[model samples]
Target: MNQTIDTILNHRSIRKFKPEPLKQEHLALILDAARSSSTSSYLMAYTMIGVTDPEKKSALASISNQSYIKDNGHFVLFCGDYHRHMLKADEKEKETLAYNVQSTEYFMIATVDATIAAQNMTLAAESLGIGACYIGSIKRDLDLVNDLFQLPEHVVPLFGLALGYPDEQQEIKPKLPKEAVYFENTYKDDEAHMAALDQFDQTIETYYRTRSTNQREDSWTKQMIKTLHNRRNDRLTPFVKEKKFNNR
Candidate 1:
């Protein structure tokens, strides 16, 4: 397989990192990769806030309840930003669509752009033998995080990324097989889908038994049922709406 495919296939979420920082040039190149990602309609609606300061990182770590946010050599928060576009529209004295409300299309596009940038940075880090982890728990306490980061309107903190040299290696998490995920011209019925899902669940259960960290005696289906039964983050809708994304 090609080196790129090898890097992609061997991906793992690294939680432990060495204290040493990444080289300045390497960090720059990684950021360049992030900037090089494709954006929807050329609207680079994402902002990355790299935090190295002890105080700021500590605050973010508290918010995320993940100590790696403070301990990692670098922590970056990727934000979905439309405020910049609005400011640009003002500069041009052109009337632009008011996306202050929950514009689903705009939110989706911005989120996709941010995700692409994040994945690009992650792959670049992996290629350089650096380890990284995506921190989605930042969304759990959005208000505190927003205040800590001083986010303006139309800017949502989608996720945080922590990067450093590896301190530990982890087993790559198994994914659903192609039979379960990939489809032909038409979508399959419940019977076909459930059969594939059952097989995948068995595979995941075996993987969990063998994994080094947080090993659990459970299948994918059971985990999903447990995790999804309660929509714990009811605040998500209100929080996004408070950020002025409130739209139907």
Candidate 2:
């Protein structure tokens, strides 16, 4: 494989990081890679907030309940933002675009745009020998995040990316079989999918039992069951609506 593919294949989430901050040049390169990502119709409805203040990082770590948020060399919150687009329209004397901006379509567009940019940033950081971890817990309390960042309407924090030099190296976790995910022209039958998962469950169980860190006796389906059962984020829809998105 080429160097790019090798980099992509070796991707791992690095939780423990060194105390030193990222170099300014590396940070610039990562942010530039994020900006270079493709956007929907070139709207580029996303904003990245690089958190450097010790107090602010502490607050975010408290909010996320993950000390790595504060301990990392750098933390960046990626936001789905349409506020700038609205400002642009207003500047051009086009006030009628509010309805489209409030539509669920636009909200999805912004979310996708932010996600794409974040992946680009992650790859760039990894290629430069930096470690990174994604913090989805930023959505745990949107209201507090909004107040902490003083986010205006039509802008919502989606997730965060914590980057730093690696303090610990982790094994690359296994993924589902290609047959379970990739289909030629149509999705595989449910029975075949379950069979594939059933076989893969053995591999996952072995992985969990044999991994050096946090070894546990569990299968992917069991973990998925617990995850799905505990997936209760009632604040998400209300918070999104409060940000004036998806009303239509």
Candidate 3:
């Protein structure tokens, strides 16, 4: 296989990083690779904002609850930038190009495009020895981010990636059994699948018990339950609609 295909298969998220600064050329090259990722309709609807400011990075780190955002040499926020579509419509004298994205297919398309590009960048960084973590918790504090960044209409920050050289090594996280992930032509809800999942849950609990040692939920199922119960911020949909993404 080609080098790019090999890199794609070997991808992993990096959370720990060395403080050494990434060179400007390396930064440009990785970003160029990210931009090379496919975009739906060739709109190039994704935008990555590089953050070099200490305070802003700190704020992002605090929001993400992932300290690596602060420790990394560089922070890059990927966004689903729908504003360009509006600009094009306005300049082309086309009307009815409303930014009403609520429940629209474009919303999902933009999110997918941005996420794909973000992963491409992560792979690019990793291939060059720079570690990185994709931060998703920023959605929790998008209000703080909207005010801080002055985000325009139809533009939403999807996630951020922290970038630096590895200060610490992390093992490859074990994925679910192939049978657990892959399905036949039709989804099979057989007992074998549930059995595999239960086995995997035990495996996850074992890893967490050894790694965390905290008095809390142990299994993957328990963790999923905890997240479902603890996470109450279901406001993102309304917020996105408010931002004119979904017309509702």
Candidate whose lDDT is highest: 2
Evaluated against the true structure, the overall lDDT of model 3 is 0.78
lDDT of 2 by residue, 83-199 (tens): 887675654454566666889899999999999999999999999999999999989889988998899988999999999999998999999998788778887788878888998
Tens digits of per-residue lDDT for model 1, 19-138: 878889889999999999999889898899988779988888887788888887788899888777777566334333454335888888889999999999999999999999999988
Off by over 4 Å in 1: 91-96, 99-101
Ranking by TM-score: 2, 1, 3
For candidate 1, the lDDT comes to 0.86
Candidate 3, which segments miss by more than 4 Å at Cα?
1-10, 91-95, 99-103, 211-217
Residue 46 local lDDT, model 3: 71
RMSD of each: 2.0, 1.4, 2.5
lDDT of 3 at 145: 75
- Evaluate all candidate structures by whole-model CA lDDT and list the values in order: 0.86, 0.91, 0.78
Candidate 2 vs candidate 3, TM-score winner: 2
- The candidate, 2 or 3, that scores higher on lDDT is 2
TM-score quality measure for candidate 3: 0.89
